[model samples]
Target chain A: MIQKIMFMNGYGVFVWFSFAITFVSCAIIYIKTLRTLKKYENEYAKELNKLSVSERKIVLKKSKVASQVFASYNKSF
Target chain B: MFDLINPSRVFSWIQKLINFINSIFFVVLMIALTFALIISPPDYLQSDSVRIMYVHVPSAWIALASFTAIAFFSVLSFIFKIKNLNLISKSIAPIGLLFTFLAIITGSLWGQPTWGTWWVWDARITSMVVLSFFYIILIVIHKLIEDEDKAYKAASIVAIIGSINIPIIKYSVDWWNTLHQPQSINLLKGTSSIHSSMLLPLMLMLLVLLLYCALIFLMKYKTEIIRIKKKNIKRL
Candidate 1:
């Protein structure tokens, strides 16, 4: 059974290659997108931190996305 | 109505959707793999090579659908001038391009054994290549153009023009004699040449890919939102 599954009647190479490429590509893109998202979030949080406390408070209150990024970024730390 | 889609309201939903997909994605993927690689019997003619269809078909479908969506949103943005829609088209472009590349590569893999060749510039294949180039140009438009509004307009125009090739890709097999086979599943005519056993795995794999697309789109869209906010921090 193992041999049959592996060889697939001499077509295993193509079968396996197709699956491998599709999945590995998906995984790579997923990791890249995730890293980019994290980097952006971190940068956004740091930008908020550059503001004065009152200004930061005002920004956070006015912008939910800003608050979310700041809160998530701080949580990561 | 527009207020409902405002960044803040949408931001909270992105978190929920991302968490939900992350929880379910792996389980669905495992099930899909089981069906695609093991449970589903090999084709009588194509044998194990048919397994490639599980991924190839879905990738092609996603690539075509993404470009269609980008075109739709692009045209709508042109009419209504909604900046938000541009973000959606932008988020979808990379995912589409990745799938387009996958389709071509996997199709080649499937081709070598089944068709006895790596590639032929058949109508369907050539048209799909055209679609991928369009995706590349759209992404480059976004990256090269510095002005946000200008970039969006340029990308939208490119998307609209690229969309003209979409129908050509779809009907190319019928329109021209090609090594590529005609579409086996037809939702419009409610017909499928593929058997149920194969169809089940194909659908399951599609579900997995769709979930993956959603996750990526959400993350990219969220990043875009944060980017806009970050740029206008002073106003905020």
Candidate 2:
């Protein structure tokens, strides 16, 4: 209705623009986070593949330690 | 379901889906905002000045919401040591500050016509100003600390402490005699001062604003996660 259309009036520009900025900024961030997570996974895989038999064992050991540390830390929470 | 725990697949898909949904939300919000603007009528009392509430209310809501989020995330980060939580709290800081800035500016603009002054240190105004200070302090603390773990700890403390102020700010007017009008957005006010006609658009605008905040907060949190991931990789 014509009556409803006039309700927002001149203020629509400010309201909409502000909302747009916030939305776009968030979307960009979200995409970037996923990309980084993918990158990390790829890097981890490559490093694992490149390790020698003995080195692989040592690396796994370190990972076990790291996980344990993380678990203990988590428990404190 | 066990296969779904594959970090890259799971997280990337979530990211993509969230981004897609957020984009859709943005478009829908745009349509709604434009529709409201074009369709809604100006107030008889304040005329175009009433339009200010649409902007002012949303920004205030975001400012308040952001602080509340930061406080909650700070608790998570401190107790759980979740890097994601810490990053989220840090990233949301700037967005919160931005909304607070908008709220103050729109408030001043609204005040000129309604209050006969551009600025007043009324209970609401003073509390909002203090809220802005808290946002700035959070940002400053985040920046000043060199060690990430220590910084997270310190900032978490600040965030938790600052949250105590939010209730005070909300109730400041109620607790003290003030020139600032009481909550206009209240539902139980008997629809006397604000007519039913005006309330509809006002509520719609608020929803749009809240959606906007959620969109921004999600985006900022994502960016922070990426930035931290990169930082960790670089260190390795």
Candidate 3:
């Protein structure tokens, strides 16, 4: 039974290999995107940390306002 | 009801949907793979090699579908000058290219066994190659143009113009003498050449692949949005 599944009437290698490559590619893309998100989040957070207390508060406020506008725009949709 | 939804809410909703799909995508994928590989009977003519169709067909469908989607978003971005729409088009391009590449690769693999040749310059194949080139050129242009607005405009224009290839790819086998077989599944005619047993697994695989594409597109788009916002914050 195991041999039958693996050999697949002698076409097993090609069939299995194709599916493997496709799935591996999908996984790679997913991981790369996640890494990119993490990288940017770190960069942004680090930059925010560099600011003085008052400056950081002001920057955060601006971002909050921008997000509010975005939220409203989304609601309008 | 639509007015009640905001961007944050929509974003959160997409995240939730993606998470939900992610949970089930693998289970469905395994089931589909098993059905395709073992449960489905071998083709009378092609034998076990016919299993490649499950992957090849769906990837080709997605390759075409993604370009159509990119063109639609490009139009929206151009008309409304929406940065988010442009970012979406940008984010989707690489994934579209990946599908196109997979289609070509898997097609070549299947062809070598069944058609006795690994590569063919048939209408369907050539048009798919052209589609991949269009994607590469768009990516290159986006990289070369440093100005985000200019890059977006240039990419959108290219996307819209290159979209003409999509219909050609769809109709190429019909219009020309080609080794590539015509489309097996036709929704309009309510006809499919595929057996019911094989079709079920193929459809399931297609669904899983499409959900996979959606998950990737959303993740990439979210990252792009955050990256852009960070850049603006740094400038501020």
TM-score of each: 0.98, 0.69, 0.90
For model 1, residues B114-163, the per-residue Cα lDDT tens digits are: 99999999999999999999999999988899998999999999999999
User: DockQ of each model against the real complex?
Assistant: 0.87, 0.09, 0.37
Question: lDDT: which candidate is best?
Answer: 1
- Sorting all predicted structures by lDDT, with the top scorer first, yields 1, 3, 2
Candidate 2, residues B186-228, lDDT tens digits: the string is 5455443566666666677667666655655555554454444
Cα lDDT for residue B67, model 1? 100
Proportion of true contacts reproduced by candidate 1: 0.88
Local distance difference test scores for all models: 0.93, 0.66, 0.83
Of candidates 3 and 1, the better by TM-score: 1
True contacts kept of each: 0.88, 0.05, 0.49
Best-fitting candidate, scored by DockQ: 1
lDDT of 3 by residue, B1-236 (tens): 33333333455565577689889988988898889888998889999899999999999999999899999989887897776778778888998999999999999989998999999899999999999998998789888999878999999999999999999999999999999999998889999999999898899889889888988887876667667666776454
Question: Model 3's CAPRI class?
Answer: acceptable
Whole-model lDDT for model 2 versus the true structure? 0.66
How accurate locally is residue A58 in candidate 1, as Cα lDDT from 0 to 100?
Answer: 94
lDDT at residue B136 of model 3 (Cα atoms): 93
TM-score of the second chain, cand. 2: 0.83
Scored on chain A only, each candidate's TM-score is 0.94, 0.61, 0.71
